[model samples]
Target: MLYGLIICTITVIIMSTVNIGLEFGKLDTEVFLIILKSFPIILIIAMLLEVLVIGRIAEKLVHTFSDNTDGFNAKILFTIFFTVIGMSLIMTVIGGMLGKGISPDSFGSLSHWPRNFSIALFCELLIAQPPARFVMKKLHLRQEDKLDYDFD
Candidate 1:
């Protein structure tokens, strides 16, 4: 639950900010307000989906791909790749639909989802996940079993 919450919060904030900027071409008070208002809705949905869906799938994938003998770097890379792929696909569809419903004029068509998904995946891998892991470690919020991997 803590993992889900942290990831969801970071992912939503970064993705929302970038999407809003892309849509509006500028960040203003009005846009900021819109992002703020939408944050809870997106965050809640993301958290639920992460906990119920993505997290389970990711755990299974990691278990299948990683053994106790696997190096920490290999495990981390596998986990991140699985997470980015799963979350990107799910969030792109959800975000695109919500964006269209919320402001049809601002969001482009579904055909643009590939680009959006790529950007989100890139941001998650490069920006959000590392910082989130650091924060979780500092706060002692990470589960020992889930995060622990043999560094050797």
Candidate 2:
């Protein structure tokens, strides 16, 4: 919990710093306000993307794995790859498009989108393991082949 707080605080500072030169006062205020107020919306959108977009897509792709071939570890790797790279790229394109018409004074803060998206992707990755297990189990992945999660 303490670590999460520290990380969140640091992220906010980094975001503020990134916006320092890109936008002016009014635009900064507006964009910051929008970010603050609309954060829940963004989070909801990301959640939906995880469920409606990534989850379904991963389900389809994961089915190709044979228990004798691709297993838990492999699926996790592919899911992470597809989720982070694919979603981040999609968000980047969308952000770029949105950036075209309007110049928010704080629009410069968008430099953090990728970073934020990465963080969100990581969170999604963590949540993904349970579903991954379910899928792997359904595929008849055995316990003996499981990778030992050694912290050392």
Which residue runs does candidate 1 get wrong by more than 4 Å?
Answer: 102-110, 141-152
| TM-score of every prediction relative to native | 0.73, 0.43
Candidate 1 lDDT tens digits, 22-135:
878999999899899989998988887777887678879999989999998888778767776777677766777777765664354555567656776777677777877787
The deviation in Å at residue 82 for candidate 2 is 1.2
- Name the candidate that leads on TM-score: 1
Residue 149 C-alpha lDDT in model 2: 35
The C-alpha stretches of model 2 lying farther than 4 A from their native spots are 1-34, 65-68, 97-152
Model 2 alpha-carbon miss at residue 74, Å = 1.9
- Judging by lDDT against the true structure, name the best candidate: 1
lDDT of each: 0.75, 0.50
